[model samples]
Target: MKLAELEVNGVSWSPTKASLPVLHPTTFTVGAGKVLGVVGPNGAGKSTLLRLLYRFQKPQTGYVRVGGQDIWDMPARDAALCIAAVLQEQASAFGLTVREIVRLGRTPHRSHYATSGARDEQVVEHVLGFLNLHPLADRDFGTLSGGERQRVMVARALAQEPQVLVLDEPTNHLDVRHQLEVVSLVQNLGLTIVVSLHDLNLAARVCDDVLILKDGHPQGFGPPQTLLTDSLVSDTFHVDARREQLAPSGASHFSFSLPN
Candidate 1:
């Protein structure tokens, strides 16, 4: 799939006109083939921002543009064809095999009465391989482990052949190894990626840039190296954060503690 740039220009959303916006007007850009991480505490509107990117929720004030075209102006099918999302809550796929679950991603490209075409099968197979799910292709989806299920969900999203992929809390429940696996997979996907993550260190390692949110407002947006500082973390998360360098790799990492 061709990479697409994602742009959020002054976007904001609210439940109702009178209620305050859950996500205040926010703007950022993810270059084609780059990964953008959205990080914030609960209720900080991280999920709300992601919903706008995948066209699940329209912005109340601004435009969400992908590849320089406004997503809202495009037909929903067209939008789905280019943007795919793997959300925190997945739809139940009881009795469906892994391959069957992945094949459903092609729905946007097919007619209601149409059978899977050769191209559809090709895409599904390619995605299965890309995500290393070929071994589990015929396994019942309900039988997979949490990490395996999450990988399958990612494979399903990849089957859409989307230019932009949106993932919300992709590593929420996985163990350390699985979390690394998922983040590594995302890093090499070669598509524009917008993901919401609670793990700051993972975000620092995987993201090209980070957007920090607090109480539905943007606290900062820039490369994590310079943007994620001790002060910022303390202010946003209310924890004492210290940056440390690991001895073996000399990679930067954050250590947090409760404030006195």
Candidate 2:
């Protein structure tokens, strides 16, 4: 499925009618079936952009659209059906079991207070299996480790079967193995994945394209190989790329030099 161009028109948000300038009235497009990394320094409007996409906050001056359709114009449920998000914050668990938490994703497809039908059950099972959460399906939501909890959140999002999956720092608390597993799974799914990442190397490995946000505006957006150059990494990310060649792997890897 093609990701309709993401159109943003002078989108800005402010509190108390005074502009905070999280996003500086920027406009851009993120293509489909590809992962776009939103990378920037702290407080650069990463989450704000995500909130705008999910309609968690209204824009003061502009609009956001998918498939040429205004995201706000569509019903909230419809938007939910099209996009799922895994944010970088804790969600209060209702003391629900893991299975029950995942099953919540079926809500949009079901009537109010409707039971889980056969297809819904199958989808839930599939998601659990995909995320290797089947073992913890019966566990308490609050008891899982941070990585496990993150995986569960992703599983719940996957259960929505959305065209676009937006994650904010999805690898934050995971060990190396789980981090790789989750990102690789996302890649294999071929969904239009828009995620904010702090790790440039991980972003390079997973995302086909990258969107750099600096000072709450578009710095660059293109293929990783094209946009993730040594100079760009040094300037935009404020880190030096120590380029080295791997003897066995025969590939170049970058290490960051700490700032003076």
* Angstrom error at residue 180, model 2: 1.9
Q: How well does candidate 2 match the true structure in TM-score terms? A: 0.89
lDDT by residue (1-260, candidate 1, tens digit) is: 88889988999999999999999999999999999999999999999999888998999999999889999999999999889999888778879999999999999999777999999999998999888899999999999988899999988888888999999999988898988889888988999999999999999999999999999999999999999999998899999999898999978999999999
**lDDT by residue for model 2 over 213-248, one digit each (tens)?**
887877887887678778877887777776566799
Per-residue lDDT of 82 in model 2: 80
Which candidate tops TM-score?
Answer: 1
- The TM-score of candidate 1 is 0.98
- TM-score for each of the candidates: 0.98, 0.89
Q: What is the C-alpha lDDT of each candidate?
A: 0.93, 0.81
Clashing pairs in 1: none
| Model 1 / residue 117 / CA error / Å | 0.5
